[model samples]
Each structure stands twice: as C-alpha cells, then as structure tokens.
Target: MVNRVPNEWLLYCRAGFEPDLTAEITARAHELDEPGQVVAAESNSGFVRWQSRDSRPANGIHRGLPLMSLVFARQSLVAFEPLSLSRDDRISPVVELIKESGWNFESIWHETPDTNEGKSLSRLAKSLSRPLESALKRGGGLRRKAGGRRLHLFWLAGDAVQIGMSFPGNRSEHPGGVLRLRHPADAPSRSTLKLEEAWHTFVPKEAWESRLHEGMQAVDLGAAPGGWTYQLVRRGMFVYAIDNGPMAPGLMATGQVEHLREDGFVWEPPYRLDWLVCDIVDKPMRVIDMVERWLIKRWCREAIFNLKLPMKKRWEEVQRCLTRLEVTLKAEGIEADIACRHLYHDREEVTVHVRLKGER
Candidate 1:
C-alpha cells in the first residue's frame, strides 16, 4: 500500500488562485516568526502545501497563523494523506487517522476540488460520509452534541485524500469553503451575487431578520446596469445608483432607485445612509479613499467595496491596502469592524465588508 506521512499544511483555494494563497501563507509564516516554506503549489490545482523545515518552529511560540486575514485561500488545515487506492481496506486508514486525532468530532464533512474534475468525486463523497460517520460513532469518536470539533475529508484526486479537522466557530461554515447560492432570475447581472455573498460572509445569520430588512438607505457607486442596487432594492432599500451609464429598466421600475448620471468619485450622497457599495474599476487606493471617506466622515454607517488589484505582487498590495485602512481608521478614532475576502465571484480583486464596530 502506498501511503505517505502527513506533515504539511493543506489550503484549498479557487483553482486559479493557488499562487495568491501560496504567497500569503509564505508571507504570514515569516511574519508570525514561523520559519517554513511552501513545499508545492501549482496554478489551478485548488490547494497549497507549506512544509516547515524545522520541527517545533520559532522556539515553540504558540502563534496561530493569520488564516482569516488571507485574501486568496478558501479553506485551510494541517493535514497529511495520499493513501493507496489499491489497498483492500482503504477506509481503515482514514478512520484510523480520525481516531488518532483525539478530537470529539461533532460532524463529518467530505469535500471535493472546485474544478470540473473535482466535481466527479461528489458522488463518492456522498457515499462515504455516512459510512465514515457510522464507524466514528461506533468507535466513540463522534460526539453526540453539535458544538464540538468537525472533521474534514478533502478529496484532491481520485486516488488521493487529505484528512483534517476544524473548530466550528473558528472555521468556515460552508463545506470546502464554497458557498452555494442560487442566482435570482430577476437580478440584472451575476454581479449581484457578489454583494449577497459579502453580506452573508460578514453578517451573522441570526441577525439577518433584523439587519437586512425594509427601508434601509443605500448607494451603489459605479452601479451601471445595477446588479448591486438590485440586491438592496430586493431587500426594500431605497438606493442611489451612481454611474454615468444606463441602468437596468427592471431595477428602475421598482421606483426605489435614483439613477445618478454622474461620476461616483465626485458624487456624494445627499444624506447620511445605512449602507455604501462600490464596484468601480478605479485604482485600489482610490477605491479605498472613496470608501474611507464614507466611513470616516460618517456619510454612511457601513460599506462593502472592491479594490481592483495590480498584476504583480498582488498579496503585497492587499497587505498594504489593509494596513492603510486600519491606520486611517485608527487615526480618526473610528470604531469599525473590517473584513476582506477574495470571494468566489471576484476576479483580480478582493471584497471588503465594513460596519460600525458598535454593532455585532
């Protein structure tokens, strides 16, 4: 049987974004005083591995790598695997690894890659999840309650699988870091999904009933075709769609949208607002400045915006922008919760989710 000792960290990302993730992980390890290097990561592979050359790195400093601060990776874990498919008892090794973890797993999650080839393993995952659960239960490894740790089975290939574990609140709620959202038929364009994903990522689910309700005030900068505006209107918000181009007629018919035929950069909202969203194709820092003004000047209570990134040194650029955002906010004595992520729908950009820090 072919099996390798598992000693590397596994990170799953969008297929084409492995490099961004690899760069962030390498950078973060160095920053955290963890001396390690990315052992292997190829474009479109959906995963990256960081191998630490020195065991018990950095004199055993208990530092948790800043996984949440990352802009490219989707899901991350420390794992080891690649069990032989030829073994008659392939499931035995997988179960054995889980037992050895010494965790009281509350649930089991089986995930496949994000590529078309990855989808081929879905049926296999479905078939295995229940059996694995049963075995774990029989072995007293599965917890009866729902709040304990969870186990992750990542299927990287037909013959290769990686085993890992994650805490419930600390890790992503979606399996494999992919959020499954249905495209609303009436939405102007797919771009609407980006804002929706941002809300879901940054806002807690239980608070949705109160926070995303009717009569909210919002503005969509560069909202030409009105995808972002469509989301606010759907939630019964009166929106100012700022752009120089025409908007979707369906959105206008709602009578809640004010189509501002002017530049979002120069335009300002007439009154204080509940939300601000920007999707302009401007320089990243410029976009940051635009969003920061809305927050610092108290023009809007919260915002979600995108920063168009450069071709090279993308991770460094992201770090710089985040730092500037934090420093600017601190200098002004503004309390705000800021979160950024490279969403599944984003391309060459990352999305920011910000709200007044007073509210949860």
Candidate 2:
C-alpha cells in the first residue's frame, strides 16, 4: 500500500467536451485505477486527477514526463503531481506508465458530498474561487514584485482547471477546482476572448500560433464552410480550397483562397504547395493514402490534416496509422516530423501536422 495519496488531480481534457463524455472518461479512469480516490476532475479539457496509491509513482513528474515522447499513442498521461516539461524528455515504457499515473491526481481523502464524481467538479470550483481570485488579483503566473499582471485561466470543459498568474516568475496555481467566469454586460465581438474557449481548449496561445504557417501556401481538400481554411487565411497564407460545396463568404471574399470544384482524392495542385490541409469527412485509409502520396511525391513541404476516428479501438487505430506512416516514410528513405493531437476545436477526430525533416 502507498504511504500517502495525492492532494489534488489536474485533468487535461479536450476543449468543448460534453457532460456525458466527461462522465465516460471518469468512469473509464475509475475502471483503470480502482478504489483510488478522485479528488477532482473535468470532462471537457482533457485532464483528470485521482487519489494516489501504493502502486502510484513516488516522484510524480520524474516518471510522468516521458509520455510527451509517445503522445501519438492516442492515450493521455496521468500525472500524480504537477509537471513542467521544460526539464526532462525521455522515451521508456515504465516512464510513460508513471507519467500516465501521475495525471490522475489524488484529491483530499475526506468524506464529503463533493467527493462524488458527478458533482465534485462544481463543488471544487466553488471552493477554490476564493484562492484563485486572490491569485488573480496578484496577477496569476506572475510574481508579487511585479505590478499588476494579466491572469490566464485554461479550463478544460469538464476536466481540471489550470490558473496561471503571469508575472516575472510566472506562477501557476492548480487548486483542484472548476472555474466560473462571469460574462460581460455587452455581447462580445469576434475579436473578444469570450468565444475563445469554444474554439480551442486549454491550448496554449503559442501552440495555436505555432500551428499557423504565415507566408506559406496550402491546399485545402473539401474546404467547404472554410473552418480550417479560415485558420490558414488568418495566417496570411494562400489556400487552394477544393470542394463541391460552397465555402463561407468570408473565406471566399479573402481573395487569397481559390475554389476548385473537383474531387479531393483525384485533384492535383497546379503547383507544389508549401502546406496541405484537409478536412474531408472520409475514411481513415483514404486520407492516409492522400498524405502518403503527398509525402512520396514531395508535392508539399508540410501538411496538416484530420482523421475522423472510429468508435472503438481508437487508440490502436491511431497507433496503426502512425506506425504505418513511420514505416513507409522510413522505407522510402524520407525524413519528416509528424504530430497528431486532439485539438481544442476537434470532435471525434484528431488534427495531424507533418513537415519534411529538412524543411523549415
């Protein structure tokens, strides 16, 4: 048996997650790590915490950090303690296991109505609002020595809340609570931050910005409604939007986008593209083939695409695709960087990014 249990769990969940989905994740986590206590959790933001046990890792982040290396496996890491990735990066099964375990934080071992998973999220949120407000007042993710600072909160839909006080030291506080923010008196506009949560989950602004390739060219397959294209255009990149459906008026008006009424699978770019982005609601293999063809033919320098996931064995499916891509690329004597993550805006699918090894 373990000597001590964790005090809180910080769950990281995808953005815009639903209540039922959150419940399912909690139930699944419970099934995986049984009898252990769940101090707090959220379903939307793609994170969770549970009580520590004898079986849990002693040094939470020491063992839990390696999952960053293998995140493509389509599962999540459970950190028993807080983790800062700037320190360590490794690849080992045991390390991955420990990293996975630590994320399921250990809530306070108290017998209370809030201990129940169903209502614990709201209860925890109410409890921590006081401290969080204090932290915010002082400028979250910041130090007191610095003057007034901006407070940033990354709340998973139903997962754990991460409150960052940005000052010199950039202190971040996770008090195991759900976050509650009051809406403004007036209706927010497009540039306002109000709708940010709906578009992206606890995704760091840097991550989102980095994903954009400005001054780059892209090919959009089935780019109707232009959701993905909107992102690309905002970055100042021209896109070849290929779809039979009508694109959003805003995207079409940009004049940076070109509409082509052609089949995404058979269409060929008039010129080599800098990027290839697709949101085709097609089968996994078919999309995979397009990506493969692009890489093999060297049609594009980099690419970002989506894979609509199946209901069952989702993890295995992602693994298989990754493996196949790796193997194929290797056999072809090609080098590339690949990443797949469940983005804040994605649903039942994952966004994939690929760049040739040598290209910037």
Candidate 3:
C-alpha cells in the first residue's frame, strides 16, 4: 500500500488560473470533509499551497482528492514546508531532508511553476539535478523499482524549493504536468495540437491501436480549416468535416475527408460513427446539450469535445456541465468512462473525452 502523508498539498495549474484552482480545491476539500485553508495563492502564480486541518494519516486530504479527479489542477503532490536553501550548498540540505523522511523514491523530478518567472529557474534546476541524483544514490535514498514513490523538487526561486513525493499511479507522469508537444509542420492550424494532446491525455497508450485504429469513421464539428480533421485523416480514418467554412486544400486533397457545408449543431450523421469530435466556440451548456444528444442516441461510440468557458466561474461551470452530463447518461442507462483535463495546448477551455463502456 502507498504511504499516506500529512495535511499539506501542492497543486499546480495554469499561470492565470490560481484563483479558480484554489476555489475548486477548497470546495472539493469541504465536500470531502477535509476542510482546509489556503496557505498561499498569488495571482498568476501557477500554483497553490493548501493544508487540511486534520493531518491524521487515515483522514489525509489526498485520500479524498485524487489528483486525476481534479479539473483545475494539472498536478498534485504531498508537499512539505518550503525550504530556504544555502546558495552554496543546496543539494546537501535537500539530500538530508530525503534521508530524514526515511522513504525511498523510484525517481526524482526537478520541476518549476508554469510561468515566466518559473521558466527562468530551468537552468538552476538542470544544474542541480545531476548532483542531487548522485547524492541520493550514494545515500541509498533512491531506488528504481516498480510501484515506488516518485520524488518532486519544486523550484520556486534560485534559493528556495518545495520538496514533495507522489505515489505511483496517483500522479501525472510528466514533469510540471505539462506535455510539451511539437506542432506538426503540415497541420492545418495550431488547434490540431489540442486534439492530439487530448488523445494522449485521455487514452491509455496500450489501448490506442484497438480504440483508435485505421479505417474508423469520424465526424468533426466546427472543422473549418480542417485542424481537427487533419488528425482523423492522419490516423487513417474517413472524416465528415462539418462546417460551412472552407477546409485546408492539402487536407481535402488526401481523399479521406468529405467536407459538408452545414451547421454542425443542426447536422446529423447518417449512421453511427466511431468517433465524434467538436471544437465549436459556443456556450458551455449548448455544447454539453449537443454532446448529450449524440451520446443518448448512440450516434457515436466515443467523443472528444471542447467547452468554451466563461470568464467568471470557470471551474463551477465545468463541474455543472460534467455533473449534468454524467447524471443524464446514467439516467439513460448509458455507462461510460468520462474524463476532462485542462491540457497544455488548451486555453479558455477544457478537453473532454467520453467512451461508452462494454463496447468493442
């Protein structure tokens, strides 16, 4: 069993979403009966520090707040108090702290916040990472094995850091919870990265071959300029691109896409399709309603869509939409695996993926 730590929690998010993420985490903690106070939440900080009132191992906050279940937080870990390190001997103090914890880590990641200031610490992180690893190895605090805990060293400044650890299978695999993907040179637009990131974030890598294979039929709503359609074509799937706007000439030339000049919200697929993707810039509720109809009627086996959130109450709106969608689907006897994430490539929106259960 994974060891449960104390009350402190560290959550990372987008640069400008500190408030929203704090609110969401606070509300969630209350709902889980682990009410806590925010220790630090600066505007555009790209991170939040919260501590629960009850620090008991049995009632630890992380027990209720699995990182994956959270919408606003990109990464979450059990954190200790921030350390003020000596400029000349940063590695010794950090290494000593790990030794004092009496815990072994499978791997260590030197991370920073996702902001301009945070980016500036990259060089320092790189400079210290090698020596830190060497020290941990010499001290026997580092062990590479299955199911071992992962260590995190969060650099807040050149001489300040927050040390944490996360259980395997309970935290993001990427450092800082950001997956930096290269934009395809031939893609229609940057929006293509959103869909690509969605697939990587939501789908298990081992299941990709069967779930997202060649010759599958897909529909791309609001596919103007074919950004999303390009992904489908590249995957060897036939696409019905729904939009009155023009498509990319190169994409259309692939002979795999059929562009339909029609309003996406009004158009219906002639038959059930393998995939349904939408990037319509519409109200969150409207997008949710449309996606509901498609799933309720079994129009598609799976779906990936975006919900353009309002300026205010972004987290609340996301919860309402997700709750309504799940409740509606359950009421209709439809079982599905639903997931949503504020991906690296997404802004002002969240990507959602829904896959019907017990379907091949």
Against the true structure, whose TM-score is highest? 3
Output the worst ten-in-a-row residue range by lDDT, candidate 2. Answer: 104-113
- Any idea how many clashes model 2 has? 48
Ranking by lDDT: 3, 1, 2
Report how far residue 174 has shifted in candidate 2, in Å. Answer: 10
Q: How many clashes show up in model 3?
A: 0
- lDDT (CA) for every model shown? 0.79, 0.51, 0.88
Which stretches of model 3 miss by more than 4 angstroms?
A: 1-6, 54-59
Cα error of candidate 3 at position 20, Å: 1.5
Score candidate 3 by lDDT: 0.88
User: What's the residue-level lDDT of 292 in candidate 1?
Assistant: 83
Candidate 2 Cα RMSD after full superposition onto the native fold (Å) = 11.5
Instruction: Residues 1-360, candidate 2: write the lDDT tens digits.
Output: 212223233334433333323344445445454444445544333344444554453234313322222222222223334322211221122123233333211111111111244344555445544554443333322234335332333332233323222222222222222222333333212211212222232334565555445777888788776766766676688989899988777677878989898999988877788878777888877888889989988899877777887866555566678778888988999998786655434567766767887764
- Deviation in Å, model 1, residue 155 alpha carbon: 1.3
Residues 163-256, model 3: lDDT tens digits: 8888867788888998888899999999999999999888889988998899999999999998899998999999999999999999999999
Off by over 4 Å in 1: 1-7, 52-63, 145-147
Q: Model 1: C-alpha RMSD to truth? A: 2.9
